[model samples]
Target: MTQQPIISLRDVGVRYKRAGSIFRKTQYYQALKSINLDIYPGETLGILGRNGAGKSTLLKVISGILKPDSGEIINRGASVSLLALQAGFDPNLSGRDNAVLSGMLQGYSRKEIESKLEEIQDFSELGDFFYEPVRTYSSGMRTRLGFSVSTTISPDVLLIDEVLSVGDKEFRKKAEQVIIQKIQSQQTIILVSHSEQQIIRLCERSIIL
Candidate 1:
């Protein structure tokens, strides 16, 4: 039997209202237009485009972080974990606290986060930094913590933005390993990245949006 399509989008479009200059009273930016896609289980769909190509907007729609102005997104089966580093984070909280908070926001209980806490801490390699307030962390440190906590508990679908580039080489390697394992395990993945080599390595099919 054919694997079910875990994600479906038909004629989807997202328009953002922009404050226009004096010459132009108002306008709308069309982020995604007439996009049609079907993402099945066990697929890694690479999305490629230029800087203003609406990659992030498309991802947000699929991950339920944003709603499209037109058309429909039918998501069936699978818990989604989004790799938007700055998202789901509280700056006032320590890295460790933020990890558990983020997990709870994603429907994982405190007990579940407790069970995976050590692994998240280890993978982040933040050491004493994990105990420090998030505001004290550099962008790389924050990204590492976010990446580890987000991926430690496998979700059925993963959405990754270019935030992976924010970390160090060692962290990048760890992230790649986690991604490889997720793909091999038949978890659906959608990603946006500047590295075509990484995309080619992980994804079997691609869409230019």
Candidate 2:
């Protein structure tokens, strides 16, 4: 039997207007144009594109963070999560508090999030810095916290946007291992990356935007 798509997008398009001063006219750009795609259960799809190619835009649309100006999206009521550096973080909150908040946003109870706090803390490896406010964190520290919190909850559909590009070699290896395990467990994923090798290795089907 053939598997059905968990999410369907048809004739999708997004538009953006460039910032302009009073003397300059604003120009509009089509971020995505007449795109049609379907994301199936337990399938890993890779999206390859250069800068400004709407790769991140596409993922954001699917994750419900951005609304397309045109076309329709049909999601089969699956829990969706987007894993992007600094995407869902608050600069005023500490790493620990942010983890709890992110979990709550993912539909987990506060009690459950608290129970997983230690695991999130350990994986992030922020140590005492985890207690400090996010404003005190470096870019790498923020990435670690965001990644750890997002991965703690296994969503039905996960969208990853260039998050692997951050962190040190050791952390990147650990992150790749985690992704490998998720793939082994047949988790549905949509990954946007500029690395063609990564796309080839992790995805059975891919598209270039």
lDDT of each: 0.84, 0.87
Q: Which ranges of candidate 2 are over 4 A from the true structure? A: 19-26, 86-93, 134-138
Question: Where does candidate 1 stray beyond 4 Å?
Answer: 20-25
Candidate 1 positional error at 145, Å: 1.5
Estimate TM-scores for all models: 0.89, 0.88
Indicate the TM-score of model 1. Answer: 0.89
lDDT by residue for model 2 (1-209), tens: 18889999999999988777899999889999989999999999999999999998898899898999999888999878787444457889999889888888776899998999999899999999999999999988888888888777788988888777778888988988888788778799888899999999999899999
Residue 69's lDDT in candidate 1: 99
- Residue 162's C-alpha lDDT in candidate 2? 78
What clash count goes with each model? 0, 0
- Candidate 1 contains a number of clashing pairs equal to 0
